[model samples]
Target: MGVLLVGGLMACAPAVSGPSQAALAAPRVALEAGHPERLRLVVMGDQGTGTETQWQVARAMAAVCAAQGCDLGAALGDNFYPAGPREVTSPLFRERFEVPYGPLGIPFIMVPGNHDESWLWGGDGASPRGAEVQVAYSRVNPQWVMPARQYQASVSGLLDLFVVDTAPLAAYLPSVRPQERPGGPWDAAQRAWLAQAVNQSAARWRLVLGHHPLYSNGKHGDAGAYDHLPFTFQRGGAVQALYAVACGQADLLLSGHDHALQLFAPQPDCPGTWTAVSGAAGEVGGERRGRRPAAFEVYGQPGFLWLEITPQTLTLWAYVVGEGGAVTGTEIARLSKGS
Candidate 1:
């Protein structure tokens, strides 16, 4: 079946199966072709299930990027769902990552999510190579670009993105998932690296990327029952890291874990740091709710985020993908830093 994207782009990519009846039942939005911005990038997370919904979203992203000439695609963790792949040669890799996203063509800058680190816990009965296997896979696939668990990259004059390994660090903390015991010796080291990296970056925009959010409206939000009180109970890493980013003059933070589309207004305390949650890419975890903190929030709906940056302004678009794979978008917000 052909799904049309904005700009007359056809979305007839091969899927393991067609989108479910429920997805098709939802309201459909027809997206227009091509964005007006010069530089564009796509961001989304929690999309590694290899389901038809995931394929639909992938096809939408591929079409949008193709129509507008995108520079890169960012996967905000949860790259592989459940326990992650056992090895680079695992069939899960082909079905989940290679097949769905191979059509996009742009390099995917990714981070590891909690599900991606399930292999770290011996009791889970998952392979121990979850994290390393993905990094290894990146060596083979030119499109998958994860150099290290925690590293930073710059797009010359546009931005500098720092991807962090938050799972192991959260596991190291006392209040954060004490039962899981994700003990890795690198928690302190990653924290240190994040601090230094944010402070040292000289790019126009400094974006910190990770799977877990510092603040979210979905299940991980401060008010939610699941992963409750993350900011206070979890180690000082997330808060400290945000502070560092704000201190370094960074305005935007991108993350996924909450499984929703959320845009948080700047905190009264941290005036310049705006957080965007685009986890609604592949799957919806649960309800999204945050009245005071969230500038805009959408739960259960599945979509990805489009960010376009010119020399002076950055505009964000939230593209909603229907069950039939048609994409409709809205201009959610924009930011401008004085030149």
Candidate 2:
């Protein structure tokens, strides 16, 4: 339930990926105002398989956590591949788990990923299901935390985060057959639950998170991956879950299915709210096995996002993580909220 969160410092000098095409596209969106910042939150996703770079970044972030007074870490999902944490106590867990963020030791909470659930809950009890998986994960990892499947969580009073699972929505397509779905987040009960959660959260910031991204100019877009299956399904409303925050109650939405990073804002008719795809956490290097459109302005780097929240402004920093867990290329842009 509660974790004491171990804190430490970070090593600087990360692997230089490249310049963000997003910055090259149009001018960088300047912040409304800059000033005294309050909370500094780090966002990392798609690190389930574990990489030397990712592990190094986590180690580095641990130090920033202490200096910035970071209370927790939000793990976007796919925390473990080929299966979630079913083999919680395995040696791979040590190399992949304990070694990576063991330095940070903060309460790291996660949403589900296609890879995580495939191993943990879905794929039949033969894989890892019921209390067995839960017991293994919770009992073994002292720093790990995940809400009930399809649930919302409160972060520091200012934000209420609705963590959604999109697997079901995508699987519902005719290709997959609704009844044939092994598992997915697109459930009727979850829909009702999310609606109620939004209405109840009066926080200044409402964010919905998941593993699959809703908007991105990454390799996952266009041609093949453009299937963006979930976005077009059930009318745009299914993909529109990312837009729940567009109403203004929500400010930021995050995901990481594409294995790349892209920051999005009001493009054409898509108004309100900002979405980010933080899929590149030292895995595929931003190159999804899919084709992305030329119009897509991508960050084109191997790194993660850092969200810095202050009493006045909320800033998102895209940092490039190095092999040793250090992050550089600190670029800060604020999220504007007017009174």
Give the candidate number with the greatest TM-score.
1
Each model's TM-score?
0.78, 0.70
Error of model 2, residue 169, in angstroms: 2.9
lDDT of 1 by residue, 1-339 (tens): 443232222222211122232321111111122332345778989898777778778888887787765666789888877767767888987888878877665566777776776744521222224666787786666567665656665554466677776665443234233332233334444555566667766667778887777677667663112254343424424434433444435668788877888887777655778878888777776884554567778788788999887767888888888767788888888988788
Give per-residue CA lDDT, model 2, range 1-339, as digits (tens).
Answer: 232323221211111122242321111111111122354567787776665656556665665666665545677765665555555466655766567766665545456665554523431112213213533464456455442445555544555667666544432232233432322333444555566667667766667777666665655452123444453542224444444433444566778766766676644434566677776664545443433332223344557777767555777777676554555755545676776
* Quality of model 1 by C-alpha lDDT: 0.64
> Against the true structure, whose lDDT is highest?
1
- State the weakest 10-residue window (summed lDDT) of model 1: 24-33
Q: Model 1 has how many clashing residue pairs? A: 6
Cα error, candidate 1, residue 164 (Å): 0.4
Error of 1 at 5 (Å): 25
